[model samples]
Target: MKKTIVTVLYLASLIASAQPTGLPAAVHPAEQLAALDGGFWLAREQHQLRQLDGQGQEIGRLAIKSTQLDARGHIAAVVDYGSQQVQLLDARPGQLQRLATLPATHFSVEALCLYRDPQALLHAFLIGEEGQGEQWLLSASPARKVRNLSLPPGVVHCQVDDASRQLLLVEEDFGVWAYPADAERPFQRQAILLKQPYGKLKGGASQVVALPGGVAVLDQAGMALHLVRYVGQSWQYLRSVPQAQERDGIASLAQGILAQGVLAQGVLVRDAHTAQWQLSRWPTKAPTKPDTLPIVLPLAQTDPVAKLGDAADDPAIWINPSNRADSRVLGTNKKQGLLVYDLQGKEQQLLAVGRLNNVDIRQQVKLGTQTLDLAVATHRDDLALVVFNIDSDGVVSELGRIPTGQQDIYGVCLYQPKGGGLEAFVNDKDGRFLHYRLTMQDGKLQGQLLREFRTGSQPEGCVAHDAEGVLFFGEEDKGVWTTSARADAPSQARLILPVGRRLQADVEGMALYHGPRHTYLLVSSQGNDSYVVLDAQAPYRYRGAFRVGINLDRGIDAASETDGLDVTSANLGTGWQEGMLVVQDGHKRLPDGPQNFKYVPWSGIAEALKLD
Candidate 1:
């Protein structure tokens, strides 16, 4: 029995050596291969990656299932199937250090490729199978951040050709699909090369070899390979290459040589230079126009301030009752002080009030026997409420300073009750709030602390609806909370909008737009760069949210990262006949200048939102 077994093994070895293209006698065979600069990587049996030199000499080995090289061949990414992670390795000579490991979710990684964008940033594209014919494309950075791209189901294989800047994927029943490998833009479907029922291909595509202008597909169609080109936005069959034996894997090598890996026979080399390979540029798709929403025209913008960063934070508007055209907007420049702008957005007055954060206006406050238009703001430098009395000529003069008695003062709003007298609600960075009542004593305004409350977290952007006796404030990381405006009212606060429901964290500002019978509460969802409006009445149901998109008519940019906003129901003149909304744009990217306030017409908002 031992002699018979030895004779069988000897015959098997002899038959393997007599094959047309035979590999070197080794214990394990290569399942996958990737050619690099001076060497190549081989995925051998037992989940090992063997690095070989040009002379076919083994240099180093690692436990990886799949391997790919970056466009510059400076980095190599290997897939660890058992660990469910992709390992990035430095591909320099004698320095095969693992740089980073990115976690993957799919159960099995079928294929792996490396993509380098025009900026020379390296990315790893991994095709993972999650069972039940489900597949996912994961684009991962070296920092382990992954973005999953949705793909058609039943993807068999994927490859990237840096020379042609194309990403090719083979589906089970659907043929080959092409995508642009540019990392700067989002992945878009380029075209479908071939389908099962229409072409001469009988079975699913098992492998794909990327050529100069197109790709060569190897399927089970009479055991032959076919070349297809993308021309005129469609796939056109070029030619076919007859194969003597079935090739399991094919790779484009240097010097115009094609390496084909056969099952029993080793690697076969063929001169592809003689083939009439069509070399054509991939058709560039026309840029699709961005979906334009209703334009919110910016009537004017505040003059760019000198402060580079953290200059503009909040804004408040006070309309001149006698002259609607003389309305004034007061904006806080955190680094400078307060700036007063007219209806035309021209800076008419500048007060060096020292580091004020937020400002609000209260009209017709009867102080003793005198009526006053007051603008109160949070004085960050002194932790006090800085009051300003707006004269009939639209000029503002300092009234008095009242210490908030808090370490940090953030948002401030004035409430003038129907019963007369004015109250200021001031909040600190730690969510603590103090309500102060303003009165005249000896012909001078004085602020007396009436009540104090806490919102359990950081809060800012408070507004008062005096008619309804309701005060709304945003709890920075939480949501909008409403409470009583009267000092004698209950301390219990009700949440109008909770965190994470249409509203994101750090809810920055709150404004009220009072219509004829309906009122709406607009909150700045700073985290998502959106504005959410809700019914101001009880059960404050959510209306819709709209982003201040680009306005090409006025050549003004969109509003984002808004801190404070103010909307008025009273009509101003000219373009603002239906009133106006003023918002502090944190990022003033248009024309590339400093941050400033953007004036949006209230009519546009009402018509766009269909708000009565």
Candidate 2:
């Protein structure tokens, strides 16, 4: 790679010409400025929050102690360390409306920044003297504490990179430490760049501007900019861009604008002593690898499973024939049992039938003369099929257990014939499957061995498409394969999609959503935390992929590391007119509880992916 240094040349003459460009007057000390949509928001040493236009003109002003703008610029968080209060404001051009005020940390704050979580909630990170750091959920009514963290001493500046999921803290005399932005994840930190004799930095790090997969740090003492590349799990100091002249006090930094001056891209700097600005210009460029686009926000998330780590594994949606609105979701607590949740994500029932891995449901099953809804799960403890009967009123009760001779049972799916025969296919960890015919003989449920199937590798998640008479299996660590579901069909399975760029490995879950013009297959690409969509029928043309983003409006975290998912093309009365897609949430946040399942409306996925 070519070693390129982004050199920012500062001219003192620009200082005298600053006022004409609408730059703030050089009277009060320069403070850190928050980047807004059309301009910037800042709290000067004069004890007031000021907004500046593109030309640096004063567009709005508020009497607040300190202000920090979220990356989206939709909300402004003002912190008054002295009074120990935090204020939230709607950050619009010329309309900085005060929304709410709440008491923040009792410790006197030194540095603070607003971070938006995967669930779209805004949190304020309060950094006090020494390494005292606390995270508070400001978006919650009355505000609540999230977690307490630690940082290297002397962090006068901090920023959250929502894109990279990293919280950057500049240790004035040392370097920059990138902490996991998701507070719920493990507490880990990486030294991104170091200062002085031990490293390449010319001066101590003062401020940082987050780039797509990197950051540009401002070395205050040396009057230079350090660009750092964020590699997987770590960051490296790439190079530096030195300034030509000194303009004093402390400087503020912001990004995301069309660069008109110094470095690379839109890195803007304002001198605290002069209130004058120095701009760094970076060539506007397109992103390299495509990002997880067209995000679909989750509507609701179920209560965390009883088991703590890696418990919630799969989910199956049960549509209510009598009342679609009251449809329930069936999820597996791999460490516990079966969990039944309503559309609102409230746990409606729990059946401690043993460790259940994967789950599936079939509505209107013929149980003698009564048509009932049934849920079938792979009981890992017994390596058998545990059944539950759901009633018209959405009530649930244990039916019976069907034992499979397989050594291990990891995934299960039901194949219900329209003519009234209910069968199930259970997969084991060694890639062996057993198909069983579920029957009622002498008024007792029994299982009769039908046929068998074999795969090349381990399989867990499986979905049966009744319309196509085909069963799709996720060969974990590989990709997907499908075979005929007919009782007498060949046991051979053909690989439809392999592990590749579009379909990431450890393919966790497979789901089928039958639409009016198109039937699609949704696969959980666990390696990348995204879902890949493909044609459900033959060729299985790849449509597109998307990530479940946090719904800031609802405070529901995105789903990740999914194990099993199920979709239904029925009118879910609760406005999921097209249908509903439910998946296991491997990583749960918004206070970091146990794993749960997230409810996503299929219509949102259809619209985002432009599905027919």
Candidate 3:
């Protein structure tokens, strides 16, 4: 490798005596600074911001209580403590334009930092002195959250490492802690160990600066610059370069890249230089391969649910036997009833049956002398199975409700045995599953408990392969399990996929895609906001996993926190010529409406994972 300034990192930390003799006019003092790569800096003092050049010359300034810039300094997130608002600025050189402003918090703010995700969405993370932490999506509306952090008091500094996708926090009296930066991920943090014998911080790090793939820690007590590199999920102490740590009391450490028109591509750390902060640079290896996220966007989305706030739960597709293009989607509005939509995602019918949770459909099923399709959902109010009949014209009407001989009934799926009739599998909150034999007696559909079994934990989502009569169910926090779906079959369940690696916990929903070329079992890996696909036959080869992303052209947001999903192999016109997959959009955004379902053609999934 070619020699760079990184070879002599120790010499780079030395404070040069040369000052900025020819400097820009006066200012209070650089209280906080974020230096950009191209000799630009975001210097904040109280509610005013001063843009500084490499020679410590002020170009422009703005008014903001607290602020931080992104990794490349292309954007800045500012907090107005007085107005309780957070703003985003287009921080590209001279154009510090105010892009958007929204309410941040109602309480007093403590610390703030800016982070950009792999999708190029800007986010602002705010921490309160009373241990309140919020991550706001700054690209559009500023405030939103998945995991709201309960931080410790006095944590005054935080930085988001875009390279490693980790959030670094500085607590002054305690060692630094690193956490997964994505808000969709669960809240988890690990204390980064950086005590290297003589270079250890007496109490904790005085200042920590995030580099491309590493972090530079300044120890005021021990007088050292500790550089730690992030290697595969954890941080490793590389080497601590000795330096005289000085507390100038004028400003905190500001870090940036020195590349454009400069002598080298190195980390630039500025210290107190008379009236302005001087610069010191050190080089390191460039960032590794770009992060290839596992995300899959939907082709179209249905209208937002009528009822707001987590009302939409699961979905089922009713394929029109006469005209496949007219097939309607049956989605459960947990707060209302069932919602039926056509292939174009418009609500066709709304059945005010009851508070329905999950839903499934068995097309062309025998009910008495009629060959009508049946849609069933678990009714929370009745503790029963609410059944619906879909006519050939794709119109859905209430059939009857069969009280499930259980409490708190959850998910339900339909199956037909090779030699026999239709069966429904419904589960309780405590892992109790009951299999019922459906019958159309006296023109009223009813269920008779045939057999039952219980898992170790709560299980909801389940789907049965009609060709094989094998049932697949998700044990939310555990994993997916399979068993025979026959009415007279024993409850001999077999563990298929355990929750780990690719399949995260709370596995919410499952669907089967019976394509001409491939039959795969798709499960909603709700824990990570992604879906897992496996073979339908024995061994169940793990095909791959993907996430439903936002549709920019259509202005539909990504789906997350999915409770239930359903798919069909019948061609549904235009984009869904190869069939379609419908998933519940748990956390709806991009206008922030009630929850809805997203539709993705099988071709998109096949192309994304490189499958047939």
Using TM-score as the measure, the top candidate is 2
Q: Each candidate's lDDT (Cα)?
A: 0.66, 0.72, 0.71
Candidate 2 per-residue C-alpha lDDT over 1-612 given as tens digits, one digit per residue, 9 for 90 to 100: 100111111111111112112233532343544555553544344467666655456677777655333334567665654566666787788886678776656666666777766545678777865899887777666666666777777777777766666788878778788897765445678888886677777667766666666777767564776777767657766676666654332222344222333222344455534556555335433322434467898888888888899898888888777778988888888888988899888999988888989888887778666677888888888888988898887878888888887788898889986567788988899998889888887767899899887787898888888977898888987788888888888877888989987887789888888888888899998877789899988898989988787665676766777778888888987658899888887777666678888888898998889887
Q: Per-residue lDDT for 348-460 in model 1, tens only?
A: 98898789899999888898888999999999989998999999888988898988789899999889888898899999999898999988899777888999999898999
Provide the clashing-pair count of each candidate structure: 0, 10, 3
- Clashes in predicted model 1: 0
Candidate 2 whole-model C-alpha lDDT, 0 to 1? 0.72
Candidates, ranked, lDDT = 2, 3, 1
Which parts of model 1 are misplaced by more than 4 Å? Answer: 1-295
State TM-scores per candidate. 0.56, 0.79, 0.73
Best by lDDT: 2
* lDDT head-to-head 1 vs 2, winner: 2
Selected candidate, larger TM-score, 2 vs 3: 2
By TM-score, how accurate is candidate 1? 0.56
